[model samples]
Target: MSGYDIVKTRETLIMALKQDDEKAWAVFYELYAPVIINFARKRGCPKELAEDVLQETTMVLMRYLKNFQYDRKKGRFKSLLFKITESKVIDAFRRAGKISRLRNSELFSKATSEDHARIITERENIWDNEWKTMILRESLQEAKKRVNSRVFKCFEEVYLKEKSVEEVAEQLKVSPNLLAQNKFRVMKIIVDTAKKMIHNLEKS
Candidate 1:
């Protein structure tokens, strides 16, 4: 993640898309196609059906992106993507007869309405969790690259490996106080980087 510039990356991609730049479109697909496909798979869609949903989702975005407005206060671009994906997932379920009728607990009760609101909430939760996890992971990686190698190793030993502060400090031949300071410094870098990435992603 070294040298990564998320804000510049997003702006370039968006500008390329606005201009119908083929290379930018390809890069966009490479970055997001797998994420959307995995999201569908996590929602219980079969592999083939998930791929179909992804294709449909991409087509929809392509068709409408020219007219799409970017408004961070209203929502993020990714949220718009998830909304489209949700609809496609629902359409897939309907086509497969999964939503033809909702039934109560097995062995005999009257039909019930599908809880679409609950479904949407669940999917949104999934999306939010995944998105945050991705941002944090990338941030940590970038922080690792930017920090002093020894200090990062000490932080990793203490925080990531769950070692006692005294144990790791002794092992690394550094004072416990110094190790603690390194951990704090590295953790701050990771948190700050993640915040910046999230802000860039949310920018209109």
Candidate 2:
């Protein structure tokens, strides 16, 4: 799920989906599971509902693989995952409303109150932060393994710990100029890696 040697891209996903490959299924799950879960939870779903949404969305992709063809023109796979999460979350809400008269529950209403609005806002912010962190952490971990340890150490000091280039140069006994170069080097690694992973996600 988090590696840098991968060559599989969007075309690979389409081929895998058409053939129903297990590796393709795993790749698809790795890319979108956290996104769907976080998206559902951010939309006020309970934890169980968030998980259910993730599962349902995955099944929808697997079962209806032929129903919706992959198209970059439709948008990136991240957007497609959000669409899937939104649809599943709404379906859950509608089903819950049908079963529970508490669609209008006081506790649910309180979620919109000024006093509780802060809570809802904070929850959404936390979820967004977590989602971004998940992607960055995965990217960092994969990038770390692929590149030189010394270069990654410079990156950790400068970007991960917010150290100044001067500080990193002093700590690593490297020239500031070299530190700056390493920063770009690490950035390129992560950006390229994540783009590949994220672009092909949600395909199946």
Candidate 3:
């Protein structure tokens, strides 16, 4: 993610958590939950097991966010999420009987020694970040396309304006409750579409 994307996502999450906004939590889930599933699948988990792991991992995330630390200097939200993913992937693989042998349990061992051969970190591509930035940019564009100008503008007022959702609702003459739900709806569509676009871009 670019610096701006990271900052935006982090700010949105923090504000939502502060307000105990269920809609914001749901948006966050839509953006990240698929990543856990994909990571499990890549680590050789079966489809059912992959889904289970994704659920388990998300539950863990929910548990942590009550006390979760958002550290930009340490890395982007992607890194924190990926660290959870890496742990959950290993756990899923273990449960699926892929690594019963003791010596092969280490992350280093898995990357270096597995027959399917995960990419060693030393050789991992930097294009991943570029791809993510493109996807996020496109997803925001797609989200903007689906909503009424007023609804999209309401989202901008609340999220982009740093105004409270309550403030946005009053500005638009809509209910605050409705405004909050709309916030998540638009964000989810944009994020999911962006992920798909990025995946297609990578294939090309």
Candidate 4:
């Protein structure tokens, strides 16, 4: 498969998960662990705490996923996973006494309904940012696999590393115009691939 193999539908995966299938659990971890870790880190968790959240969230998923009722009308799988991961992060902070500091904040102690809504929106933004980041990274990896290796390297240098385009063009002995074309072409592939992944993620 060029990108993530979308072989398992959400329903099929859930059924396998409910059966205690080891492979299904492994797939679940590989797909979601990074999102959980990044979500925690973005929420101000330390490295250790973020890792703890990953472990705790994994356990929680294993315990509860077997009985999960998948209903797209209610929410997507990511939303359910986000709620569990967010809960684990809060528990980690509570244990580390960080929640106490947050609790003492005026925003926490004297927040209005609007204030609470803002907090929820901010967290949702963080989650979406991390999710999209992961999608882009995976999409880029798939693009790399399909693109000419040397051209892709040049694209990375000029586009991602933000090196002087003139310098990179001279070193690579390619025209700046050629580099520009490569950038545009490779970016199109990445964006297209990411869109497919996002569609699957939301609908699977």
Candidate 5:
């Protein structure tokens, strides 16, 4: 199978990882390391600190994935990942003597149970947003490979580059109707692909 097919689903990759498949581990790291780094960066970590969190998170996963249980009814793989990355972020902060910064920031108040719950909820929201952004980005790349070059270009100009449909059509010398159709078709492909990607992680 192609690397894309092999790494397409989290469950499949996790199973491969459990068997100590080196390629599967590489694919897993390629897919998730950025997500962890970006999550840490959003939480105000510098690039160096974010890279530290990524390494720490990867080590934790390596130590745990041998027996990791992926029960969807219990929780999502993404959430487990988020929890791990979050723990690493906190640890990195502590090492840098910046835990007080997080506690004193707007996201945290007094460290009470209520505050702790609120912190999790807020941080989860941030994590989810970053995760979705990464998925959309990957989906867009896949969409480009699946669609016509012109169609993908139209979609990029109109949707991603924020160009008007009329302007793109005129520039590309295509009818506005054609541009709209291309936009809709590419959007469907991207959204569908993104949903499937999310399901691969969250559902199974």
Candidate 6:
């Protein structure tokens, strides 16, 4: 489901979570678990290990959930979650002996607060990109369901497939102007949906 489909605001979800609402926790997990798992896999963990990392990260988040405070100036909640996931990734690598010196290295062992912040910022960037991509994809899927099939097809042909407008118009047996209109209409829906999804995600 698109983030737009989630009715509760981020604050509401967090409040419910604090109250030990099972539904809220489930919704929270559904929203973020895939991204966390994908981040681990992208960082080179195998699928099985990635899944393990996700579990470990989720448990850590649950333990510390109540301590979280929403402060946009500091960062989004995803940034904190990304930090936890990054820690888990390091732990996984350490366990596998992939980075034998990481634990004793200056970066981890004697890092200044600034160094840790820089590392977290880098991980947050990766998390943000993945989250945006997922939201955009979900928004596109949601927009497709709401738009006319022909209009969506026009969007696919002109934007996604990069077909010449004239070619697509000819194939669709429609005037160039009509095809262009369809493409514009579908594009608008997609962009609007994506914006909404991003807004909701950032708030969350």
Model 1, runs deviating above 4 Å? 1-4, 8-13, 20-35, 71-74, 94-97, 101-114
Location of the lowest summed lDDT over 10 successive residues in candidate 5: 1-10
lDDT of each: 0.75, 0.70, 0.62, 0.80, 0.81, 0.77
Candidate 2 achieves a global lDDT of 0.70
Write one digit per residue (lDDT tens) for candidate 2, span 114-168: 8567855665465456556666766787778877999999888999899889878
Worst 10 residues of 1 by lDDT: 103-112
Tens-digit per-residue lDDT, 99-129, candidate 5: 7876687756646898778878989998888
Flag regions of model 6 displaced more than 4 Å.
Answer: 7-13, 16-30, 66-74, 101-122
Residue 149 of model 2 has an lDDT of: 96
- lDDT per residue for candidate 4 within 1-204, as digits (tens), equals 222553224535555666787777776666677888989999989999999999998888788876777666877767877899999999999999989998898868888899888989999899988888877887788778879988798889998999998999998899999988888888998888888777767655
TM-score for each of the candidates: 0.74, 0.68, 0.51, 0.82, 0.86, 0.77
Best by TM-score: 5
Q: Model 6: number of clashes? A: 0
Show the colliding residue pairs in model 2: none
**Where does candidate 3 clash, by residue pair?**
none
84: Cα error in model 4, Å: 0.6
- All-Cα superposition RMSD per candidate: 3.9, 5.4, 13.7, 3.0, 2.9, 3.8
**Which sequence of candidate numbers ranks them by lDDT, best first?**
5, 4, 6, 1, 2, 3
Compared with the true structure, the alpha-carbon lDDT of candidate 6 equals 0.77
Clashing residue pairs for model 6 = none
Over 4 Å off, model 3: 1-11, 14-20, 101-204
